[model samples]
Each structure stands twice: as structure tokens, then as C-alpha cells.
Target: MENDTICAISTPIGTGGISIVRMSGSNALAIAFKIFSSKNVSQESIKPRYFYLGNIHTADVNEKCMMVYFKAPYSYTGEDLVEFQCHGGVLVTQKVLQSLIESGARIAQGGEFTKRAFVNGKLSLDEAEGVIDVINAESESELKASYGLLKGNLHKEVEKLQNIITDILSEINVTFDFPENDDEEVTSADVLEKLTRAQKTLDHIIKTSTTGLKLKTGTKVVIVGKPNVGKSSVMNAMLGTDRAIVTSIQGTTRDVLEETYIYKGVKFNLIDTAGLHDSNDLVESIGINKAKEILKNADIVLFVVDGSQELDNFDKDIIKLLNDKKVIVVVNKCDLKQKINSSILPHAEHMECSALENKGITEIKDKIYNMVIDEKVLSQNVIITNIRHAEALSKSNEIILRVITDLQAGANLELVSLNLQSAWETLGLITGVSGTEEIIANIFSKFCVGK
Candidate 1:
């Protein structure tokens, strides 16, 4: 938390086309200038928020790079920041960071830059987490959900609830002090009605967390069937790559093969498992057992079947195992005449595809994605993608409901105000601040009565 200038390799550690080294703090520009030299460029002549082509002198070599300066109060960390975009290489980037460190700047810890942003009021705690999500997002759906938080959607909602709670607490306090023969029961009823409305709002937000969590963590879709029914081909066709080995031999996929693909901005974990049939070999048996266990945890199961063949005992057994799970019967190899009856597979979505020919693969992805996500429903709502945010909302809802119940049961104004104040403070946890000052400010600002 020191104001000392901190530096680190901004880009990922590796040999690439280009790499960036970054520094932030009060002495960030000064420390950077110690090792960087540009023609006609000095501290007095430096322009803030502008890039300067310079040479960074290091213990090992001198690297020609582009350096940009971000002055305090407008930078990412709300302090003087500098970035050196140097030639991409492990040795070059490390040397640039080393020179800054030797010139009196310390290396930055993981997430310290963003944490500093939060500490300096550039971002709230939830928004800070959103920054991490955006950095780590592997799929488009997850990125969209992360942007919702980064854009202050949840923060604004929480502030609204805090304002409501502030108003209620202020009203109760004013009524208690005035005591002009007010109807106590009527006032309590009105407070109870307002609390219920906030509770419902919180309930709706908590409900969206389920989908939000799925977006954050991609759905696991396990594909299981008897071997040699083109399960590997189905995987390769969907991914447009030879991710799994395909052969005409039975039990080719003796182990679980997992890969990920995005369909309509949502990520799905495609798992190819060993054929679900009796195997004499111990290794094959273990693989079959593993596939069965994976199905239990899968968000969705792609129950594959040979479309040109009739139902075998193995297919029936696989169907029975998926009785309680979300399933999509993938009638694969449907280029020939269809022989597999869809009616027998009850309570499952049936989709036909010829994996060998890549026919209907897109439709199956559409079906799997549609089965898990409904973008239309979430289009207008702010999703609670973070577990901590969801938990805070849930805890606030619980406390508010309790206060409502106590109010209905004849709790006095003083007692109800205490509980309501607690609820307001709990809601403030999301934004990393308490409501004591906020309540005092609210009372004076919203009410015109003499204080």
C-alpha cells in the first residue's frame, strides 16, 4: 500500500511480437526517466498522456521502446503511471523491468495495480473484481457478464437499495422525534410494504446468480455412448479440429477427452468418453467407470446413438443412466436411412447429425447452447456473476425480511430503525463502505425539517 513506485511486466511472460512494462505510483515517472532517454525529452518537457519514443538502458542491453506517461488523478491507479512497449522477448521485457527496479522502483505484486485503483477510488470492490473477470474471461458470454459489473450496473443497484434504506431509517427517526400524535400502526405497515418491495428486488437479483455462475464457469457437456458410433468424429466436427483420435476399431476412446468450444458467445466443455459397454480389460473398465461418474456431474449429456442401427442393450442402459439428468439424444450418422426411433428416448431433446459429413453439427451446438442459456431473458437485467456479490444481496435480503416480520409483529420505531440500519450497513459491504455518514447526509439532504 506504499506510495513508492511499482513496476512489472504488463504483458504475459513469454517471447512474443511485443511486450509492455508498466510502472505506477508517485515516483513512477521519475523512476522510469532514470533508465529511459529520448531526444529532447526531459521531465520539464514531458507531455502527460502522450507516448515518447525512447531507448531504455538496462544492465544487459539498451532496448529501443515506446514509453507513455499518465499523470496523476487521471491514470489507472490514480497516480503517475508509465508504460514501456518494448520488443517482445523474455530477456528484453525482464531487463526493462529490472532496470526500473534497480532505479528505485519495486516489482508489483499480482493484482496490486488494480487493488490500488480500488484504494484510490477509481473502482469499487465489486468493479475491481469485474476487472479480473474481464482479464480472465475465456468466452464471450462471460465477458458480457463481466462488463455488466465493470460498467457499475451492480454498484448502481446496490446504491439505489442503500438510498431506499436510508430514506426509511430517516423517516422513522423523524417520526420518533416529532411525536405529533402519529398513527404508529399505519407507519409500521407502510414501512413493512416498502421493505417487502426491496426484498423482492433482491430475490430477483439472487435468482440470476445461477445463470451468471454458469457463464463464469462454462457448462460441462459429457458425450457418452457405446464405442465406434463416431463420438470422436462428432467432437472433431464440432471443434473443426482433430482434437480426438478417430478409428473404426471399437473402444478407440478408452479415456475421457475434453475440449472447449464457443457457440453463440457461450462456452461449452465437450467431453468424449469411452463407449458405455462392458469391457474385459482393466484399463478400458476404468475408463468406462470414469465416463459414468462424469455423466453424474455433467450440466448436459449428449447421449450418442448410431442413427442407421437399432437400439441395443448398451444404448438402453445408457438411456436408463441419464433418467434424472438433462440430456440431448444425439442421433449421429444420420446420412443414411434413419432407423433409431426418437420416441423411446423420453424427456430428452432429439437432434440428428452426420458427424462424418459434418451435417447438422451447427444445429446440435445451437440446441446445446439453447438448452443451457436464454440470452433474451437476461438481456435487460444485471447478472450477479460474482459469488460474493450474490451472497451480500442474499444476506441483505434475509436481514430486511426479518425487519419486515418484526415490524409486522409490533416492533417499536427505535427497534425497527436499529434493524433497518443494520440492513443498510450490510448492503454497503458490496461497495466497501459503511452507511453511517451516508444516513446522516441522507436525513439532512432529503428532509427540509430543522436539524
Candidate 2:
């Protein structure tokens, strides 16, 4: 992927005011000159880092374009780069790109530009991931977290911790040089204290993955219960929009209705499932089966119970079925007064609401927010939100724990040294310093073309 010069339409292919055709590699400027006619600009005559008003002539008509050049080491890929901002008719962009390809620039693979940025040392693996997050971000909180990562907060934190570990390793090495004299003062107590502090830092950062991932990808929450418990209404109330239909008739919703909404900078995938119950009707039974299947993957379940009706065997059976799920029992229609037994029902996270009245909805949102996010993590300056980074951290933690154990057991210094080095190597995987070629390819492949 790295050996070839790459070109692609950097802007969306559509009818607009402008579309950008981007090229990068050692031959970028040469390719730009091949199909472009600009005053005093030749492949060798063009000055680096200059923008020239130009015309991109295909086999037929010419379109006015703005071209910019970046020489090696100063360009996005640390090689040469060129861009043509042309009038954005899908036809015009396609013709211009086709001409450039004919002039010898290869089509860029997905994320090839950003992949080049990663290879050039302008960005780390975390920053590259952040770029994707920023592109995919749907809420203010997700954008903020991803923006922080793009600014290198996560990388800086990990690098700082790595430096500290390196220092500790140096101290351990020093202990071997002075066996009886200087080494004796650097006692087990001192070593244990440093290890304990490092462990605390690692543990705290590891726990942030829970809330961070939720913020990044959004939580999958399913609203489910027996018919007429107002599942759709509750969903509409929470979303503050008429996304799902509300009806007085039983089995009004026969399939899943999904809507996405943002709250407190976090995205929520709100799924309203058909009311669950045994039924003779084939369509309702299919819906019921789908509801059951969705629950298996939901991060949270809002199990609605009718407060206006007496507790029945069907309701009890639904509650029993959801006993192991992360359920927030919602007692709906509080305006009618409570008839359902609050005591005999199994205690879980509970909320009261009248979806029709919009009462207690704010409290429900707050409770849901608190149930999922850790306040301490949100306040912290850094977090690990990527599964790959999280996996590397987990491996690094295990190796660190092994090092600590070896130290405490009075194992040979060589054994302890080996474990500590292994921990350091594991940490390197997060930044791609020691990662495999296959892993790099996999990560970059997630990016969109011309990114």
C-alpha cells in the first residue's frame, strides 16, 4: 500500500460548489503537472508549497481549478502532495480524477492518506483512531473525547507512564551493579511502593474503557414489556420526539422501531420492541421473538410495568424472564395511582413515569446516565475507547502484574527484568511501534477512502 503514489477525490462526489482531488507520494507534483495547465508551472519548474490557479483539461473541455503543492517532509505523507479544488459537478470531478490517474497516480486505498500520516510520525496509532472517531462522532461528548484524542491526550498519558516505567527499570538495573552498598538502600519497600502506584494508575485507566466505549459507540437499549405497558410512549418520551407511534390498541407496534438520540454528549440507540407475550397471531409472535433476541445483546433494558393495573401472572413471568438482565424496572402511568405490588416485585433499578404526561422523564434520563457512566472517568483528562488499545492495555497489565509477583517472590533479577521488558513491549503495541503488519492493515482498512 505504501509503495504506490495514491490519488482520490477527497471531496464527496456530488453536485456542489467545489470538489477536491487529492494526491500524495513522490510523484504527486509530477502527476499534477501532467494533466494541468498553469502559468509558469512545469513538473520541475513548480515551486514547493505554493497554490496556483489552474485549469484541468481532459481530452475535451477544461475546468478551472485551484492547485496546491507540498514538497517532501512538509507534506501529509512526508512525501510530495498535490490537490485540485475543481468545480464540483460529479462529471467534472470524475473526468479530472480520471485524467490524473491516466497521468500515473494510483487510486488511494481507504484511509491511505491517514495511513501515510501514521507512517510519517505526524500522528500515532491513537491519534489515527481519534481521526476516525471524530469522523464518526454523533454527539457533543463523543466529539469532545475524540477531539482530545486527536490532540494527543491519550498518547501523551501513555508515553508519560511508559517513561516512568523505564525509569523504574533503570533503578532496578542499578541495584544489580551495587549489590551490597548502594543497592541495599533501594529496599523492597521502595520497589513495592512504585509498583503499587503504577498499578493504581493502570487500574483506573482500564476501568475508563467501560464508559468510554459507550460514549464512542452509544449504548444499545431496548424497551420491552407486556402489551399496553406503553413501551412506545416511554421511548417517545425519553427521546423527546414522536419517533415511534403511540396507540391505545393492543399490539400497535408489531416490529422493532429504532431511533438514535443524543443526551449529555453521549449517543443512545433507543430500540422500541413489540410488547412481549404469547399470541396466536403469527406476526405478533415474530415480533415477540425478535424482542427476545434483541434483549440478549442490549446493554440496558427498560422493562416497563403498568402501575394502573393489578400484577398478573403474565407480568410476573416477564419480570422473572428478565431477572438476569441489566434491567431498570419502569413503573409506567403513575398518574393513575399505583395498583401493582412494589414489594413482592424483585428489586432492581427503578423509575416511575407517566409517558403520556411526560412526568418523571427527566429523572429517568438522569438515572440512566448515572447507571452507565462513571463521573470520575468523565472528569479525567484521558481515556482508552478503542477495543484494540484496550486489549493491549489488558495484556500490558497482565505482564506488569507478573513482574510485580516476581519481584515480591524474590525471584532472580533476570526473570523480573524479562517480565518488565515484556510489559514495555506490550505497551508499545498501543502506539503501533511493535505491532504486526496485519494489525496495521486491519486498523487502516476501517477508514473511508481519501481520509
Could you report the Cα RMSD, in angstroms, for every candidate shown? 7.4, 2.2
Q: Report the number of clashing residue pairs per model.
A: 0, 1
Q: Residue 129's C-alpha lDDT in candidate 1? A: 73
Residues 140-189 of candidate 2 have per-residue lDDT tens digits of: 87888888888988788778668767877777777877767663535555
- Those runs of model 1 whose alpha carbons end farther than 4 Å from true positions after fitting are 177-186, 409-415, 434-451
Model 1 quality (TM-score):
0.88
Error in Å for residue 269 of model 2: 1.2
TM-score of 2: 0.94
